[model samples]
Target: MMQNTALMPGSRWKDPAFWMLAPATLFILLVFVYPFVDGLILSFRPMNGGGALANYITFFTDPHLWKTIGTTMSLALPATLINVGIAVPLAYRLRHKTRYQKIATTIMTIPLTLGTVLIAQGMLSYFGPNGWFSQLVQALHLYDGPVRLTHNYWGVLISLVISGFPFVFLLVLSYITGIDPGLPRAAATLGANPYRQFRHIIFPLLLPGLAMSFCLSFVQAFSVFPSAVLLGSPAGPTRVISIAAYEAAFENYDYSMASAIAMIMGVVQLGVVVVVLGARRLAYRGPVTGGKG
Candidate 1:
């Protein structure tokens, strides 16, 4: 049995296992947690003079903020759902099945390296009205004019799904692979058909990973910028909160207000993660294991 860790002054702080976490803890403190607290504190203060809740009031009371959230959800919800839905099946297919799964996964991850801006540019080149696709469509008389996929919500959604699917796929695959192969075999031996086996035996074990993928994919799509700015009219239909914050901070030089928006974003994503994990707890249908398979 493990010793009572709470009694010692430096049991956890000085232990090798705990020390191993120091770098990560320091990194989070310096990069994420520290900046987050700073931004939260800054959000409450006014830029000109007053110390009232003006900055937060401006953000919370704005109809534009609510509208932007709707737009963000319009894109984020569908994109995350599509990404996770497609990824889970792909992940399941690759788990302990294909020898080239790693290579396929690497290829799928190529879009991640391209960055949002580059992908937007590439889509512009490939899917723009006057671009190659437009030329082909015109030559074939597919439509009266160029198919406008860019500079819209569809463009942003497409970019997010393309970029995010691989991340979800990989995350789900890691979890899927962790499932004990014997569980499925046992189900099969008990005369469970493939579909029943998957429904009963395989799906439950993947819930934790599904929750994780949903949270990450949602967060990624929620904070989307280059895709919205480059591929869509961010100030128009695709106006997301991140764009609003960017405009406030850099374009308008409203750092305090920008900080408020930033704080809202962090809180919103945190809430989403918590909600998703809670939903997973409600929906999970997996066998418990004491250790790694």
Candidate 2:
């Protein structure tokens, strides 16, 4: 029989596992927790000698600053949806090991190897007005002049897709491969068509994973900075919350306002995650574990 041994006084401090975790816990307290708390405190302070709520009031009252939330959501939400939608079918196809799957996954993950800054630069050069695509379009008489692609909203959207899709794909692929192979086969034996099999079996199991992937991808997209500046109309349509925060801090020298904006950005991402996870709970009432079969 396994005995439940109660720890003696001071034994917890003597434990090797506790010692092992101490450094990491200390590092987290210093690096993440302390900085977050400091920022939170700074966010409520006055920027230029005003009330405590001055920075927050300015952010909410200023049309240009407040508009950034809508711009960010406009870009992030669509990109997240597209990434998750494309990832689901692609990951489903790649669940099984095959030569084609190997080749496809390798090609799909090529974007993962490239950083967002590098990807933005490539998009600017390759999809710019004088680039091959535009030249071809002009040659084909599709338009009278060079099409504006880069330094616009579309460029940013494409960059988000290129960078975000692989992450969503890898996550969904792991969840898909974790599912028992026999579950789908059983559905097939029960005379279910491919559509029915996926609807009744695959999708239900994938919902929890899909929700997580959506939240992660949305957060990544929401935090986009380099790509938005390089490949998008940052001064106009694609001026995201990050840019606004950067401008408030570095350009305007208003650290308090910047901290407030940063806090709001975190709150927005957290709210979306909570909402999506809550919806996932409502949608799926199945057994926690997929059967061994």
Candidate 3:
């Protein structure tokens, strides 16, 4: 046993005389090791040479920082809920019907290819003061003033909803497809109604997946930057945490504070993940009867 243990340690990291370990070992260290080391150093360094704890302190004390955090969550949570609300029925229909699920999925998925920056730019042409929607409103004589959808909270919210729907839809749809179609059928055979079968069986099974989707969608909305900057007032109305981080890093040349804010954002995202997982656990334990999920 002693000899075997001695040989195992020597051979574990040894070069393959027979030929296999070098590439995989190098790949892991390169991908995970270097970046982690760099990020840790970057997170602590100040914007300038002398470190006075200015950046981190500034973020913690600023009311704007909290407001941005609130704005991010306000958009993220509601958008995630809305996406989930629409996704459940759509996912169900996709699996059972399959009439044009691919087409519908593709339509919803188009926004993902066009990034937030591109979408923001396009929105200006379609929804801005001199844009088509504005002209339509003017033709209808709806209001004397220009419609304010392009440069406000609504624009940012709309951009997020457009970009984030497919993410929730596809995740839920994949989960729904994996569900045994026969299970719902079995419940129906035993005299369970459609809604009751879904409530008692299908929905419980989906809590974990839906919870995961919510976290992902929430993170996506919360991290919005290009759309908020281009389509809304980052300094005035829709300044999200990500925008604040970018400004810190680039505009003010405050890398340390930017990293600090980023770390804070990471904490919030992690907290959200934990909260969702906890809620899912609690939800799954309940009587799978009738709840909004």
lDDT of each: 0.84, 0.89, 0.80
Cα error of candidate 1 at position 191, Å: 1.7
lDDT tens per residue, model 1, 123-241: 99998888888888888987888888899988888988888888888888888889888888988998999888778777877777778889988999898888999999977999998
Q: Model 1: runs farther than 4 Å from truth?
A: 1-19, 49-51, 138-141, 285-292
lDDT of 3 by residue, 1-293 (tens): 25664356656655454246667778888997776566556767776644656556677789988678888887778878888899998887787556598787788778888878888888888988888888899889997767778888889888887788888899998777776677788889999998998787788877777888888888888888888888888888788899999988898887777877887787898999899889888777665433222
Question: What digit string (tens of lDDT, one per residue) describes model 2 on residues 1-293?
Answer: 76544466777787898989999999999999999999999999876868888888888899999999999999999999999999999888888988887897788788889889889888777799998889999999999898878888998999999999989998998888888888889989989998997888888888878898999999999999998999988899999999999998999898988999999999999999999999998987768455423
**Quality of model 1 by C-alpha lDDT:** 0.84
Model 3 bad stretches (over 4 Å): 1-37, 48-54, 141-144, 286-293
Candidate 2 least-lDDT 10 residues: 284-293
Q: Give the backbone clash total of model 1.
A: 1
Clashing pairs in 2: none
Q: What lDDT score is found at residue 176 in candidate 2?
A: 83
Which predicted model would earn the best lDDT? 2
Question: What are the candidates' C-alpha RMSDs?
Answer: 2.8, 1.9, 4.6
